[model samples]
Target: MNISISSDPQTIAENCADVIWAEDKTSRMLGITRDSVGPGTAAVSMIVGDEMVNGLDMAHGGLMFTLADVAFALACNTRNSIAVGNFCSVQFLRPASRGDRLTATAKESLLDGRNGIYDVTITDQSGRRIVEFRGHSKIVPGTHLAAASGDPAAAEV
Candidate 1:
């Protein structure tokens, strides 16, 4: 993919996230915000809405999973490479109600070649644990800046 890549670690991560965020319609639609991004780390926040509630009046499992997945995606792709989730598992701890603000923080656990593992923990505004998630990622054949204005150049890690 032809695109200009940043050299600075924080700038690269933020730039990569900018490219992703511009195309992440699902996250925008769900009111998810990219709270912070850095090399191998990301934090995304969202609020539980009535639409995301389950029959029991608690936040649906899928909603929380989506939040974690957003953070996981940002973390894995910060290295200037396009990455996709290979597998993921989430454990719901405390149920959240509508109006609760949750933040999912993803941190790199292990990185070996094109494969990586990330751990994501979701917490409510009060710092109560809500979910624990693990994601495996596989680097793909592209760069996050592929859609940016530029000719194709290799985005180095």
Candidate 2:
């Protein structure tokens, strides 16, 4: 999906998210859908399928983490800068079973220069929190998309 976005940060951010959703094959394979993306925030959702269940019939912890991670990645990248995950931790609060639709919401907690901190909460459709995640991001020197296109916006950051 080709998207033409203006040089503004918010537009760049939204375009970056579009690129992620279009290019990230792993996210596609997991059936993750981006519900929303804005500056410093993102929400993503996925349904627990039989393939995601463990022997105990509960959703695997890794899949839950991945859901939260995707939200975190989208939130942090919204600055129009290329931000990569430096560290992340997750705590499982409840077990999710097959057919449960899980949503992960990420919010930026802090941003200091090139470093940023984000918190993500994963919840079931009923709004019960299932997992908590914290992610640290490091902003790199280039924009994810504009840099590739030789746009001046990439150099502004």
Candidate 3:
């Protein structure tokens, strides 16, 4: 969270994306590209695929939820080291098919001391909202997975 740059969301997002995309295999597999990350917002997008579908040929709920979760994490940790997402609530409003492009956006709704709140939304290429989510995250003092390992810089984002 020690951002060296000014309060530019797009810039912060690009920098964070570079680090995250390079290290996270889950993000790579999901094709989750960072669209933007600012003071209180994070945006990411991906294309729907067969592997992500449910029995009805729609994208799986878990994938949708994961996408939103990533957005929330990104938004919550924009300028500081933070642990987030003790709980999340997701509601699917529509279904998405293969080849459809989806974007998930998370915006900070509240931040109080070590706790944070975010509102997330998932949409298709046509700008159709497919799902809505809200999450709560906690900002801890130190790194969780990265510092735990010998290399404190493992998760540089």
Query: By TM-score, who's the top model here?
Result: 1
TM-score to true structure, per model: 0.91, 0.90, 0.80
Model 3's alpha-carbon lDDT is: 0.77
* lDDT: worst 10-residue window of model 1: 147-156
Backbone clashes in model 3, listed as residue pairs: 1-79, 1-80, 85-137
lDDT of 1 by residue, 15-114 (tens): 8888888889999999999999999999999999889999999999998999999999999999788899999999999999999999999999999999
Better of 1 and 3 by TM-score: 1
In candidate 2, which residue ranges exceed 4 Å CA deviation?
Answer: 1-7, 147-154
TM-score of 2: 0.90
Worst 10 residues of 3 by lDDT: 143-152
Q: What's the true lDDT of residue 11 in model 2?
A: 79
Q: Best lDDT goes to which candidate?
A: 1
lDDT rank, highest first? 1, 2, 3
Candidate scoring better on lDDT of 1 and 3: 1
Regions more than 4 Å wrong, model 3: 1-19, 143-157
- After superposition on all C-alphas, the RMSD of every candidate to the true structure, in Å, is 2.9, 2.3, 5.9
